[model samples]
Target chain A: TQLLEQSPQFLSIQEGENLTVYCNSSSVFSSLQWYRQEPGEGPVLLVTVVTGGEVKKLKRLTFQFGDARKDSSLHITAAQTGDTGLYLCAGPNNAGNMLTFGGGTRLMVKP
Target chain B: NAGVTQTPKFRVLKTGQSMTLLCAQDMNHEYMYWYRQDPGMGLRLIHYSVGEGTTAKGEVPDGYNVSRLKKQNFLLGLESAAPSQTSVYFCATGSIRRQPQHFGDGTRLSIL
Candidate 1:
């Protein structure tokens, strides 16, 4: 079974629309991270939430870490075509060494 | 700075063939990891090294091996390639266990 689960494996929306992606797990994490990967490219770090119930915002992107540290969410406002890519969520293992990744959510914003 | 790089962006191999994927990092990181990305399967760790001369298995370690002879280089080897091993592989390097990892574009491999 996958330790982390991501919802809406695929999402396509209009340029001005808004969307949110979720990552859930039964296990608690020391920290959770979000990444975005473009076609033919590797994933780039977007944000990292270390505290439970912490919320961070990067320009138009907002990220939230569950109070229990067992889940997280990424919400994008005024989505643009440039926001198109695969969004991935990961959390460091209980040992705080290796990371376990979610399945991933692909987002496409058509202009 | 070429945070991390993988050689031969793409490759095709036949079953039973052996090959090695090289990952180099300029970040001078102590930890390096190898992961395979497959459609609908996400990224599964194949192997990882905490430092030079040390290696550990990840989520998926069967049919694959790794080595970290130097601080800046990590290599993944496939003794006998199989169709099941076909997928896009990624290499990552990090300064600390909790720090964000930098990734290489990826190596697209296909075993016929």
Candidate 2:
């Protein structure tokens, strides 16, 4: 079983629409990170939330960490074609050394 | 600076063949990890090294071996490869301070 589960494996939306991607898990983590991967490229870090119930915003992107630290979410306002990519959420294992990633959400924003 | 890089971006191999994938990181990190990402599945860890001369098994370690002879390089080896091992392999490096891991583009391996 996957430790972290991401919903809406694929998403297609119009350029001015809004969307949210979720990453759920039963295990609690000390911290969680979000990444975006473009085609033929490696994943790049977007944001990291370390506190329970923490919410962070990067321009039009909003990220939330569950109060229990068992889940996280990414929200995009007025999505643009440039925001299209694979979004993945990851949290460290019990030892806080290695990370376990979600399946990922593939977002496609058409212009 | 190349934060992380993998060689042989694409490769095709026949069953029973052996090969090695090299990962180099210029971040001078102490932790390095190997992962394989299959369709419809999240990246699964194969092996990891905490420091030079030390290696440990991750979520999936069978049919794979790794070595960290130097602080900046980690190598993943497969002996007697099988078709089941075909997938996109990724290498990552990170620090212990909760810093996000930086990944390589990935190596597309196909075994027939």
Candidate 3:
């Protein structure tokens, strides 16, 4: 099984602070996806990175895929209260029909 | 658009009880998935279906079963509830294998 491991499982920061979460895997994947899940709701896809070393920005959030396609990272600039949520990284398995998700990094941006 | 909808937002059952979670989508997606989320465990796939009348086991399929009799609906069933099975359940749908999936709000089940 291909597993995605996330670092800093819990994060608490003040508004305006910057934070970055990392996701790593021993096996390479064809593509990787980032998701943010708020309380009481299912996860919402933030972005999908298909190319190695590719970076995509969504407002204040920036996501980067590893050069070897075995890791990824999510960076939030000037975090806000609304940015507080569980961030997860996932990638398709060998079958490519399903995804394996990371444990997730829970972020809390206090006002 | 009601991308994906899961019935029974919250449910509590005693041991050995049986129940089914219903997932319905209107986006004409061909692939549907069932996942369980636990604290610090991320979302684990329980079952999935590529199309109607076809279901496949996922990473963790023990104690659960799924059926997709219709293209837009997928059902997950628990034959005998166990305390270990208590978790938030989410249903998702996708048009293709590589596309981003659409997920429902989730159903919280508590097995007492």
Candidate 4:
């Protein structure tokens, strides 16, 4: 089975700090997705990167897909208390029908 | 829009109890999925349905069963609850494969 691994499983930072979370995989995927889940709620999709080396920005968040399509990263600029949540990266499985998610990076931005 | 709705936001059951988690969608999505989230395991797919009357096993489907009798509703059943099965359950729906899916708030189940 394909797997996505995330680094820095737990992160604690002050507001205005910048942080980046990495998601790596050994197998290549057709596309990758980023999600942020807050406490007591399901994950909400942040972005989807379909092309290798592609980058997408959402307000204070930026996401990038690796050149080989085997990895992805999420960068937060000037993190705020509201930005604190669990960030997850996922990609389609071998069957291209379902998604395989990374363990996730739990971020806490204190004001 | 009430995109996806999961009933029983929180539930606690003893061993050998039987229960069903209901997922209803109003977006006319063709694909629906059930996943369980643990502390550090991410979200593991338990089961999925492509359309009405069709269901398939996912990565971890050993202790659960699912059925999709209607296009907009999916049901997950646990025949005999086990302590290991305690986790936060989420239901999601997508219009097509390989695209972003819409998710519900999630149902937290604790098996004692």
**Local accuracy of candidate 2 as per-residue lDDT tens digits, A3-84:** 9999999999999999999999999988999999888777888999999999999999999999999999999999999999
State the lDDT of candidate 2 residue by residue for B3-59, as single tens digits.
Answer: 899998999999999999999999999989899988768678899988899999988
**TM-score of each model, in listed order:** 0.96, 0.95, 0.97, 0.97
Q: For residues A10-43, what per-residue lDDT tens digits would candidate 3 score against the true structure?
A: 9999999999999999999999999999999889
TM-score of chain B of 2: 0.95
Q: Per-residue lDDT for B13-106 in model 4, tens only?
A: 9999999999999999999999999999999999988889999998899989999999989999999999999999999998877454899999
**lDDT (Cα atoms) of all candidates against the true structure:** 0.91, 0.90, 0.93, 0.93
Which TM-score values does chain B get in all models?
0.96, 0.95, 0.96, 0.96
Order the candidates by DockQ, highest first: 4, 3, 1, 2
Give the candidate number with the greatest lDDT. 3
Interface RMSD of 4: 1.8
Residues forming the 10-long window of minimal summed lDDT in candidate 3 chain A: A89-98
**Model 3: per-residue Cα lDDT over B4-64, one tens digit each:** 9899999999999999999999999988999999999999999999899999998899999
A4-107, model 1: which lDDT tens digit per residue? 99999999999999999999999988889999999999889899999999999999999999999999999999999999999999988877657889999999
Checking candidate 3 for backbone clashes, the offending pairs are: none
For model 4, residues A87-108, the per-residue Cα lDDT tens digits are 9999999987689999999999
Q: Is candidate 2 or candidate 4 better by DockQ?
A: 4
Number of clashes recorded per candidate: 0, 0, 0, 0
Candidates in descending TM-score order? 4, 3, 1, 2
Per-residue accuracy of model 1 over B1-112 as CA lDDT, tens digit each: 2679898799999999999999999889998999999997778889999899999998899999999999999999999999999999999988886454799999999999
Off by over 4 Å in 4: B98-100
